[model samples]
Target: MANARVDRLRMMLAREGLDAVVLSHPHDVRYATGYHSILERWTQMEPFAAAIVFADPARPAILVIPEANLGIVAVLNRDGPHCTFDEIRSFDMLNFCEVSRYVDPDRNGGQLAEDAMAIAGAIRGTCQPDIAAAITAALADHGMAGKRIGFDEHRVSAAVAPKVPHDYRDALDFMMRVRVVKTGEEIERYRAVGRMADRVIAHAGSLLHEGADWNGVQAGICDFMVRNGVIPVDEGAMLFGGSYDGDDFIPDLFRTPGKRALRRGDIVILETQGVLDGFWIDINRTAVIGRPSADYQRLHDILRDAFLMMVDRLRPGVSTNSLPAIGYEHLKAKGVPAPEKLLVVAHGIGLMPLEIPLAYPAAGLAGVKQGFVMEEDMLISLDSLFFGAKLGPCHMENVYAITAGAPEPMYAAPLELIVADHAPADRASEPA
Candidate 1:
């Protein structure tokens, strides 16, 4: 299945008129070659591995890794279904030293040698060349170094840019487009994320009420997520939009939790979004403190129906531009008001959470527009919200895997408005 994924990427590269690509972005690297780097720890200075993905299926792919990580192959088992790369180029910092050029106390002080291995046995130091240089050199050796190469522009080190020609294009978007569809192993990883989301969302529900601080709820949710091994990412945030408390539209749907306290009858919207391994779980849950508004309850029903209606129409040939209106019209026909800048009701979520082919409400939608077709095995996240007066502006966001039959839920939380226990936390005066 992983090979099938890489094969798809190769096909895309061929279509784009590129011969080869160097993938160093952790997500793209893992997607192209099933070698999972440290989860949520992707940095510019990666010391472990990188992969050179080729556009031709018959041609073998290449991999560059630090020598220390060579032993990791025993556990990772890249020789089998995990990856398709055949050539392995290992770099050893220990080889960088001229031990004989230095003075050795034990050997009559002639030119002495001290490399990484020798230093580990005695001294310590840092190496100069990065993995990018080796990547550039490998591409050059293959005779495609000056051709239009596809590489992660952000990961291309200053040492490598000069080596690679000006024609090199950014490959992150193309790679992500290829990764929109999840393989069997990738879906299984998301299943684990589904489990984590259920527990974490339930935990957050128990702590909501008047006087419950936004930050406090965030802290409790973090503890639950961490306990379940769903380590959090700083860039990826858990949000709570105090929509009803404030007047007008909630300008930012991703408003982070803070010192603001929950008021009586305020609509509490919690979005549990995080990545597990490379898969993702993006869930939206809406609840109320005390009594609920009839309009809010009605809006929830309309949103729910609209969401289901869109899911029902999702098939291989369905147009991406057709989705948003399907959802938006359902809400509007049912008397639910559409909020300002209501866009991207649905999007593909896999490697980076928001992939492409976003569905817009109007004709001139500004995303991956009309002609793009939905395919089998594409993972999507639907975000539906209603911003009206009093209580919520209800929202329901969930991740689903598009199947030949019906879309499979990554994790199914309660769709109804959760009426929590009337217990208040700390102290607060309700807004007059």
Candidate 2:
């Protein structure tokens, strides 16, 4: 998998004329190196650091971590991208030595000049003072001193800018221009994770009955994810009955399932997290214990319709901004009170809960704009959320992939409202 990804990355580098890329972010590193962490502890400090694809295959050299990381490096370099040991030293000069071999003048300087101009890109979580100096010094030594380099402006730290040797621009356009679209292999991996998450959500739903409390259900969901190997990146699980006026919106005292039995007409909302291979897929559902009230049913129907409309309209060349507004316009056309201060939509799913191209009106970043264009292979969530002060809030969210034609919904659950007609036959006792 790493080699396949590297093959694409190498092609990207050749196209861009880059000598090599110095990656410091764990996600990008994992994608490029396929080397999961080797450190026994989860400290911020990364002891086992390395770089890959310096120039060409013959010139390839990957820095090895210490002895403790030997086994991990062997596994990661199984496809053979040239592994070189970085003996620990006060200056950590070995890191510079291995990197320099591909760029700097060897005592064999004359021959090195031909490859000297090869482009070098550096990636870091944030540019800190020390990291900046190290990168700057490394580049200056390599003779690619004044060339144009790239950095993700939004994601790169301000402190790290002054240390690089050349001009750097926001590389988000460059990186996403490369990473966002899913390959066939990536799609299958995402699907496997998505299905695993679905099962966890369903299992969690089975445990939420009449007397469940906010914390109890939340805890159950957390356990469900852990036991099933899905890690939740976010903790906000909004659970409220018909319009508690957003009172349920705030952090409140945790409650346990007690004598407060959920009656037949009560609205129950279930939101779940799904993670597989460190990637995320979210699924949310709203239900009624028995038959729902007329208003609730109608409102749910509208929200569900809005969700489907958004799904139908999702495709390449469409703007995310249009989705929520269209849904709002539809609701307004139907005489539904469109509250100005509600969260109508959002785009958050991937390795992190939120990646980019958000869909909220208040989300005023240029990255969220329509001209930005939704492209093929991009994964996003199409959501329609309605808050009713009189009936609690209702939400419909689905994960989909932008394809050649339309956005394909990844989840296979029924889109309509889900009604739990009967609790277990042991109705006398509440679910724990």
Candidate 3:
């Protein structure tokens, strides 16, 4: 069966009149080839792996990686359907795998001879000395030399431009455009991760108490996520307090967690992100350590209602640019103070938290505006925040699957402010 993702790439490549696309970005490579390497966890100081996707669907995509990853790729091809690349090419980097040792039946008891032989076979005619030469050789072997090729990152383009005589163009936007729409498999992965996020948020809410500090709460969340098979990303768990000095948004959105203990009536902005099988989970839920003041209650209600209203308006053909306006108008109608301070952003979520076709204006090559219109099967994260000096920061974010009718919430968690009353004797406080 033809992979829908590769089909989408071919359609995009044909539309752009390009012969192929070279993807060096970790997420891009995984999206194209379905091969995730541990080395990709590091930022691309230098190009590590590349996936060459040809415009012709009949031409199987090629994945280029270091020789160290050959065993994993061979095992994936042998044991399961995880690795999607039809052809695997490798380059010599570190001498991590010694095939001779593994293939020795008497020395190793022949336990891993099959896998070792597979790796050795893959490295025979397909391996090169370095990334640049591997990509150059792959292109030349596939008759892509001197053809129009799109490079997802500039550094990868620069590295390969010297070795291959091809017309290379920047394709960051093009790849984002192709990735905006989710496939069935991608949607299932999102659903799974969304459920995981809901659990993490619940666990985080349970950990909030009068004396709990940001560091402890964050550590608990990270531990819970990792134990449940999700890799935490970014700040892992960001806990913002109710203390800010300006009308602008939180100055350091990605600030590390501190050891300040929670106090009675303290507003805590609990935000988290994690990854499962290349899909991301970004969720935000606000909580109060004790009873919320009237101002805090009113602000949270308005933002929550406005967020729900906007979510209801999420159907096919709705422009993402219209979402923020819906939120602002609702806040203004509710007589909320400084309604514009209630920042509203709706973005696509998949391999990355913020994918293309953003709600805000994004310009591409030649000053072309990149705006998104909601489509079926697209996953969107609608985030709303209102940082009131008196009430602290109130936030609520939800992931929705854009359908033909109403948007489907990926998780069943209600959008309500959690009130974690430290004292059970405090009967006046109600549950969130």
Q: Best candidate, TM-score-wise?
A: 3
| Candidate 1, lDDT over the whole model | 0.64
Give model 3's clash tally.
Answer: 0
lDDT pick, better of 2 and 3: 3
TM-score of each model, in listed order:
0.76, 0.69, 0.87
Tens digits of lDDT, candidate 3, 1-432: 356788888998999999999998888888887887777787658768888899988777888888767666766667666767767777876554335225554564353555645555534246677887788788777877688999987766676666677898878878888898888888987888888888878887888777765666677777877878888874445534333233222323555535356677667777778887788878888888788888778888988999989899788898777777888898799887778777677788899888865322353421112347888988988888775555566788999999898988997777899988865343232122
Predictions ranked by lDDT, top down?
3, 1, 2
Question: What range of 10 consecutive residues in model 1 has the weakest lDDT sum?
Answer: 119-128
Tens digit of lDDT per residue, candidate 2, span 1-432? 235556666676677766655554555555555555634225455333433343344443333233234334444445554223222111132354344436434364342332222111112222212443444444444444555455443223243345444544444444544455556666777888767756755655565555544455566666656666666533533332222223233211232232244556556666666455757767777776677778878878877877788787778877777777767766776666654323445463565455554332324554434424677777777655676566656766778888889777778776667675655553332222
Superposition error at 210 for model 3 (Å):
1.2
lDDT of each: 0.64, 0.53, 0.75
Off by over 4 Å in 3: 74-79, 97-113, 119-124, 158-163, 234-236, 239-252, 358-371, 423-432
User: How many pairs of residues collide in each model?
Assistant: 5, 6, 0
Q: What is the TM-score of candidate 2?
A: 0.69
Write down the worst ten-residue block by lDDT for model 2: 116-125
Error at 36, model 2, angstroms: 2.9
